[model samples]
Target: MNRKLLVLPAVMGLAAPVLAGCGDSNAGSGGGDSIVIGTTDHIAVSKELPSPVDPATSYDGGTYTFFNNTFQMLLGYERSATIPSPDAAKSCEFSDTKSETYRCTLRDGLTFSNGHALTSEDVKFSIDRVIKIKSDYGPVSLLSNIQSVEAPDDKTVVFHLKASDATFPYKLATPAAAIVDSEVYPADKPLDGLQMVGSGPYKLDSWDGDKAVLSANPNYKGLVGKLNNSKVEVRFFETAADMEKALADGGIDMVNRTFTSDQIAGIQQGKEPNIKLTEASSPSVRYMFFNVDDPTVKDKAVREAIARLVDRDALTRDVTHRTATPLFGAVPTGIVGHSNAYFNTYGQPSRDKAAGALSAAGISTPVKLTFSYPTDRPATPNKEEAVALQKQLNGSGLFDVTLKGMPWKKFLPGAVKGQWAMYDLSWLPDFPDPDTYIAPFFAEGFLNLNYPGGDIKNSLLPSTRQTADRGQTDKDFLQMQDILARDLPVIPLYQDKQYVTTRDNITGAEWLLNSSSTAQFWELGRGVAG
Candidate 1:
C-alpha cells in the first residue's frame, strides 16, 4: 500500500460498537464439541492478507493466521500469566548495528494446513504482492529498507536492508509478514475472489461474504498440531447486543472483541459457569483528531485549549468505567517511546489554562466547535467518548460544543476528507513498534488519518525518522511526542484494556501483542476439567 495504504481505516480500533444496547443474558450454553467465536466484523478476503494484516486496517487476523501460521519472528512476552509461546517462527537474530540485516530460518518440515511446502518463494510472494497491489493492506513502509529478499533455499530467508534497523525483525513477526501461497495467488490483481490457500493450521472451508467456514488442516504439523475442533464458523453481527443474544441462542460460542465495562463486569460479577472475562493491556489508544483543513480548528491554540479543558481521568473512569487507562500521550502503553507528555505539559484538566490559551491566541469569542463521532455503529464506544468530551468542553465555558454523529461506514470518509471540526478516533497498533504509532500521524505517513499537514511533517516527522539508532530514535520520538502534546494535533485521551469473556472450558487463549493480538487457535482446545 502506498501512502493511502493502511491509511483508510487506521483510526478504527478492534473494539466494535456492539455494546450500546447489549444486555446480559441469564443463561449461556455451548455446542457439545465445537468452539464458535462471535464478532461484529467479517473477513474481506478480496485480496491477499497483508503480511502483518495492516494493524492500521480492520482486524484481519481471523483470516490471516488461518493461512500463514508461521511468522517471521517469535519471542515470549511476560505480561500475561499464561506465558504463552508463539508457535510461528522459532527465533530471530538482529545485526550488530540493529540496522544491517536479519536472517530467519523457518522450522524444518513446516507445511501449510493444505500440505503445501512453505518456502522462501512463499515469503517473497507475500511481501512482494503488497508492493504490487500498492494498497494500505501491506506494511511496505517497514519493508522499504529491504534492498532485496534472497531466499537461497526452503529453510533459510535473508533480508537485505538498505539501512540498519533493529526493529525490522519485529515487523516481520507481525501479521503483515504472514506467508501466503504464491502458487495459489496470482500477480498484479486484486485479491478479492481468490480461493483461500495458506500454510496455517486451518484451511478455508467456505466464505459466503458475511460468514467464513474453516476446517482444521490435517496436514498441519507443528508444536500445537491441528485444532481439536473439526470446523469453525464465523458470523458477523451489526451490533454487540445482537452478538450476545446470538451467543445465548447458541448462534456462536465466543465473543472476541471489546465489551462494555458493565457487560464485562456483569460476566465477572455473576461468575456465570459458562462465561469468563479476561483482561489485558492492549496496544490501542483512543484519541480525538482535529482536521487541519478546518480553519477554526487549524489554530494550535484552539486545539491546545480543547485538550486542556477535557479531563482524561474522569473520561476513562466515568465514561469507560475504568475499563481504560487515562492516557497522556498518543503512544499506547507496553511500547517503546511512550511518554507522559500530555500530563507533563498540560499539568491537569483546567478551564483556566484553556481560557488563557484561547485568550493568548486572541480568541475572546467563544469558539463554536463541532465534534464528530460515529453514530449508531455497534463496534466502538465513540458515542460515549464524544458525549463526555462535549460535556467537559462545554462546561468549561471557553467553547460552545455541538456533537455531530454519523455511522462508521460514512464517518470514515468524512474524517478522511477533513470534513469534521473535531473528531474522535481510536488506534490499534498495526505493528508493535513506535513507528506504527508515530508514522501514522505524520503528514507523509501512509496511515496519517488526521492529515495534519504543516510543521507536523516538515519539522516533527523528518527529525524523528532521521535518527537511525534506536537510542537516538527514542530521543527523536520523544521530541515528536512533545510537539503533539503542545500543539494537540489530536488530544491523546486513554489507552484501552482488552477484555474477552469465555467459558471456563476454554484454555490457552493467549493474546499476541504483535500486529494481530490474536489468540493461537490450535493452542486452545478443551481445557482440563475443573
Candidate 2:
C-alpha cells in the first residue's frame, strides 16, 4: 500500500462519497447534548439528505471517526512497528510460515446493531467489494495481494495471498479493510446515503449537513476497559482558523488532524488552563516522487543533478520549521528494515558534482522543468517551501524551473498518472513497516501507478521481493537504493511530524497518535484543569 497523504480532498474541491453500512450507539453521561470536534474540512457527509454523516471515502480524520462509530477492521495498530491487535476478530494468525494464508476467529457474540450475527460471509463480501468497486474514492492497493477470502463457518475467516508476505496481517488492520454488512450494502454500485451498519463501540446518533453525532454501542463485545465518555460530535469546517476559533469559543471538545508545528507549539505555550496539547512521532514520511516518464527527468544524469541541487536542510528548517526531519532514505525511522540508504550512497547535494554530471552528459543548455503541489492542504508556508525548492534547482544554472500548483483533489490524481515533470509530495505510512515505503513505489506492485514492466521495470527492487528471506529483502532494497541514487527519480525530502491539541480536561489522548493515527473514542475523559 502507498503511504497515506494528508488527504485534503474536501479543501481541494472534490466531493467524497458518503460511507454506508456503519452505525453508532449511545453511552456518555453528558445527557442528550453532543460535544463538537472541529476540523478544517469541507466534506459533504451525504447527498440527498439534510443530515451530515460519514463519507465512504477515506479522508484522514474522518476515517478514524467513521471507524470508531460504525465500522470494524479485523486488526489495528496502536504504535509503529507494532503487531496488529484483534478488533472485530477475537484472535488472528497466519496458518503457516509461508505467511501466504491467514485465519481469524471472530468473537463469539459479534453482531451488527440490527442483531444479525457477523460472519465469514460478511468478511468475504467486504474484502471483495473493495477490489470490485475500485474507485478513486480511496486506494484499492491496500488489498491487492489477496487471492481470495474464504469462510468455512460463521465465525472463521481465511485469506489466501497471491504470494508469501509477512505483512498481510497488518494490511487487514487498516480502515480500507473495514468490515461491512452484506445485507444492506448493494453489490452493484457504491452506496449513496449517510446511514451505516457497523459493530463498533460507538454508533451514529444524528447528522446536520456538516456535523455528526455519535454514541456508544451497547452490543459491542470488544470493550477493553472502562470507556471515558459516551458521546462525541464531530464537526467539519472550511478552514483551520475557523476550527481554532471554535476551540477558543468552547464550541468543540477537541481539535484533531493536520495542525502545523507552530500551531501545536502555540497551544502548548498558551496560558489557558483549559487547553492542552499532545505531541507524538508519526510513522509517515513526506517526500517528492519524480515523473520518470518526462524526457529530462528520465535521464539519470539530470535526475541526479536535481537531487544534488535540492537543499533538504533549508526545506526542513525554513519551510517545515523543524516540525519534520530530513529524510536521508526512502523509508523513515521506526519502520522496520529502514536504513539511510540514499545518504550512504549519494552523500549530500553538491553543486560542483552536479555541474560535472551535466557537463559529462554533454549538456550545455539549462534544463527547463516545472514543479507542482497542493495549494489548500498545508497552508501558505508550504507555498514558500515550494518556492525555495524551485530557487534551489534554478540557481544551479543547469536548470530553469517553473512552479505550478492546484488543490490536492486535483493534484493527487494528476501526479499519480505521471502528468507532472516534478512535484512536491508526501507519503503517510499506511502501515508501520519499511515495506510500506519501498514496495508501493519501487517494487513494481499495484500502487506503483507509474512504474511499468511490473517488478522488472526497476531491476533491483524486483530482486528483493522475489526472495522470501528477510536478509535478502534488505539486500535487494540496498541495491535498489543504489540504482535510485544513481538515477535520482525522486529525492528523499523529509519525514513529517503529526501534532494534536487537547484540552486539559482530556485524558488518554496519547493513544490517538499511533501508527494508524487512530484513537479509541471510548478512552477519552475530562482531565483536571491545567
Candidate 3:
C-alpha cells in the first residue's frame, strides 16, 4: 500500500528553540475525557471501507488504525518492546524443540464486544479463515508456515507448523492474527464493510465520512491495560495544512501522520505555542526500484554504477533537513538484524568508483536514464528528493538523467506495469522485522508484477525464511544484504523518524511509539497541568 504524503510549499527559516507551554484552556483535554485526534489519513466510508475491516482481507496503514483498536490478538508486543507477550492468551509457548508445534491457553472469561464468548474455537476459525480465503492482498503469506490449527477444548489451541519459524510469535502480534468473532463473522468469506464484532480495548461507536467514534469496551479485559480516555474521536483531513490549521484553532487535540517537513520545522520552532512535538526513529525506509526487464538497468554493472553514484547524506541533510537517517541497506535502523551492507560495499559517494564499474562493463560515460517519483508525497518532498537525486547522478558526468513525476496512485500502478525504467518509493513495515523489508521486494513477486525477476528470490530469501535460529537468521540476512549490495535491484536511500505533535499538557504521548508504529490512543491523556 502506498503511504500518501502531503505536498507543501517550501518555507525557509532557521528552527527556533522549542518552548513547552500549558494545555489550551478552551480545548477539551483527553484526561479520561473525550478528545479529537486529527490525521491526514483518508478514512473510507461505510460502503467504501475495505471488506468487513476484516483482518483477513484488510491491509493498509489507514485501515489498521481501526483494526488495531477494535480487535485483539492472542499475542501482542508490549509498549516499546520488540518481544511478543500474551494478550488474549494467558500463556503461549512452542511445545517442540523444532518449533513446529505451538500451544496457547486462552485467558478465562474472554468475551467479544457483543458479549459473545471468545475461546479456542474462535482462534482456530480465525487462523483457518485467513489461509482458506487467501485474498491476494490478504496476509495469508504470514501464515504460510502454519500447516494446521487445532482446538482441543474451550481454552486450549494448538498450531502445527510445516517448518520451524522463530518469528512466528511476532507474526501473531500483527493485525492479520486478530482473533475474530466466529459466531458473528463468516468462516467462508470476508464480512462486508465497517461492521465489526471485536474483543479489543475499544468498540466502534459510529463511523462516518469525516470521523470515527470509538468508545472504550466495558467488557474488554486485555493486555492493553486501562485507557485514559473513555471515548476517542478520530477526524480525517484531506491535506496537512488543513489538519495543522484545525490543530491550531483547537478543533482537534492532537495530529499525527503525513506532516510536511516544513510543518515539523515550524512546530520545532515553537510556531504553535499550544502544540508539543514527540519524536521516535521509525522503521520506514525509502528506496529506488529498478525494472530489471528494462535494457538500461538489465546489466548488473549499470545498476552497481548507479548505486555507487547515489549520495544519501546529501539527500537527508539538504532535502529532509536531517529529519531522516541515511540508510545503507534494505532494513532500516532500530530494527533487529539491520546492517550497513551498502555502506560496506560502496564505502562513500565516489565518481571514480562508479566510472570504473561502468568501464569494466565496457560501457561509455553519459549513461542515459529516466527517474520517476510521486509529486504528492510531502513527508520527504519526493519530487525535491528526486531532483536532488538527479543532480547527484548527473554531477558525476557519467550519466544523463531525465526526471518525471506523477500522483502516487498512478505512479504505483505504472511502476508495477514496467512503465518506468526506475522509480522511487518508500515502505513502512507491515510488521517491524527485517523479513518485512526483504520478503516484499526480493523474495516474492509482490512488487514484481511487471518485472518477474529478482536476484535473491531463489538463493538467500528462502534460506533466510526457513531458518529458525535468531543468530542464523541474522547471518542469512546479512548475507542477503551483501547480495543486494551487488545486485542493486533496489537502492536504499534513507530512513525517516516519526513525529507526533500534541498539546504540552498531554501525557503518555511517548507510549504511542509502539512496535507497529501505529498511534496507541489508549496511552494518551490530556489536561494534566504542566
Candidate 4:
C-alpha cells in the first residue's frame, strides 16, 4: 500500500492537526495455552488497577496495553501501516471537502464486554467526554480541533471540526479516542480505578499484585478478529535484570522494555538457549533540553559549542552499544518530512570548530555547566551517556562539566520547573507525525519548558500547521528542522531501536511490534519449545 495514503490534506491552508501491534500461536504443553509476558515498570498503571483504567484518563504504556486490548476505536492502525483502517466502525471517511466533517458507520450488532449494545452514540460520547474532561496528562490536545460529534443514527456518527484537519481520522485510531459505554462510565469524570467496560479483543479478568490477568472477550467483534490464546497474564517488573531472570527461569514467556545494553549484548551472544530476541525500528528519541532561562545556556554560542564538541558516533558506539541510531534532528527517520538538519548545519564533531563558535560569541575557554539525568531509569543508560558527554566535553579542554543524578520521580519535577540548567529526557512519539516532534518541543513553554522564542513559536509553527498539502507540509517541516538546528534549544542524541525477547516456543512474536511501538498481545501464542 502507498504509505502516502496515510498523509491527509489540509483545508483553509491548515494542513490539519498532527499530534503527536499482534501475536501468535502453538505446539506442546505451553502451546495454545495461557502465555505469561513480563515487562518493566515503565508501563505506567495506577496503584488502583481496573477503575482508573479509563481510556480518557490514562496515557502511559501500561494503560495503553489495557486500552489496546479492551477498548475498540472507530479506526485502528494495521500492523506496520501509517494509515488507519476500520476497527469498530465498518467504514470511516471525511464527508466534506474542507475536511471539517467526518462520518463513520459503526458495525452492526457490536456489543461491549458486558453485552451492552454499542452504537454511534457511544462513539460520540467517548470523544466528547475526552474533550470535556481535558485531563492534564490525558490526550485531549489531540482532539483540540473537534467542534462536536453527532450520532445521527444507531450506526451513523458525524464529527464536526473547528478547522480542516486531515489528521483527524488518524487520531481516532489512538488510545485517547477509545469508545466507551455511556451507561458504565460517567461523562464528566474519569472512571475511578480499574472499573472498565470495553469492547476489544480482551477483558480484564483480575489483578494480583504486579500481574494483570486478561481473558479473550467473546463479545468482541472488531477488525483484529480471533485470538490464538484465550488467556494472557502480564507481569510487571521493577527492573530489566529481574525480568530477564524471570524469562530465563521460565517464570515468564516473554519480556519487553528496560533491557540494558549489556543485557542485550548477552542475549545477542546466544548465552540463553531457550530465549529468542528481536529488534524493530522505533521512533523513540533521547535528547538534552537546555533551560534557556539559565545564564550559561542563554547564550546561543555556549549551546552551539556544546553541540559541536559532543561526539554522537562515539556515544552510540560506547554507551548504547549501537542499540540507538544517532539522531541529527527532532524528527527521526521513517516518518515523512524527516531531515538531517543538525548534521547538515553542524557537520562532524571538531574541537577547533567548537572553539571558533565559542570564540566568535566572545566566550572564554573552560566553560562550566552542570548536567542532570535520572539514575533510576533502566530503559536507557542516561547516567553512562552523561559520563561520556562529560568526558568528551572535558577532553576538549574547553569545558568543565559536573554531572548530577537523581531518581526519575524527583528529577521530573525539577526538570519541568526549569530548575536544572541542562537535563536529559526521552520522547516516545504520541503520534507518528512531524508535528508531534515540532509542536511539543518548540511551542513556547511546552515540553521544552524553556521558551523557544522567534520564528519557531510565531510564524514557523503556525505556517507549518496551516499548510494542508503533504508536499508543502514536508517543506515546512524541513524549515522547522533547520530552525531547530540553528536555534539549538534541544540537542538530539539518538533514536532507540525496540528490542523484545520471547521464548523459543512463542510464534508470531516478531509481528507484535506494531507501528505505534506497542506490543499486540493478541498475536502471541505458544508452540512446542524447540
Best by TM-score: 4
Clash pairs, candidate 3, are 52-193
Tens digits of per-residue lDDT, candidate 2, 1-530, equal 11121221111111111112122222333233444566654445333222222223452444545664577777654333255667677677777666677888876667876677788888888888877876544546667778998999988899998876666666777767877778877654456656777777677777666887777766665523344567787787777767776777788877765555556556767834577666566666667777776775766778777777777788878877787888877766654345676777667888888888888988765887787877877432557778998888888778888888787666766765677777766566655445666666665342323545333244554343334333335555555555556556667888776665666656656654445555556655665111
lDDT digits (tens) for residues 381-406 of candidate 4: 88899999999999999999999998
lDDT of model 3, residue 409: 53
For model 2, the superposed segments whose C-alpha errors exceed 4 Å read 1-35, 45-65, 78-81, 193-195, 268-273, 378-381, 444-449, 452-479, 528-530
Q: How many residue pairs clash in each candidate?
A: 25, 17, 1, 26
For residue 219, give model 3's deviation from the true position in Å. 2.0
What local lDDT does model 1 show for residue 297? 87
* TM-scores for the candidates: 0.78, 0.84, 0.85, 0.86
State how far residue 9 of model 3 sits from its true place (Å).
36
Q: What is each predicted model's overall lDDT from 0 to 1?
A: 0.58, 0.63, 0.74, 0.74
Model 1 C-alpha RMSD vs. true structure (Å) is: 9.0
Report lDDT (Cα) of residue 380, candidate 3.
46
**lDDT (10s digit) by residue, model 1, range 1-530:** 00001011223222111111111111111223656777764444432343222322322334444433323222222222211123334434543444466665555666665667877777777766655665553345655567787678876667777655555644664555666666666555534452556555566777676666766665553334334455566676767777767765666766765455667656767734566666665766777777755877878888888878878888887777887888887776555577898889988878888899999989865788888887854556778888888888888888888888876546765665567777877766555456667765565344334555466556655554434443355555677788888767777888777766565566544432223354544444456221
Give candidates' CA RMSD values in order.
9.0, 7.1, 8.2, 5.6
**Candidate 4 — what's its lDDT?**
0.74
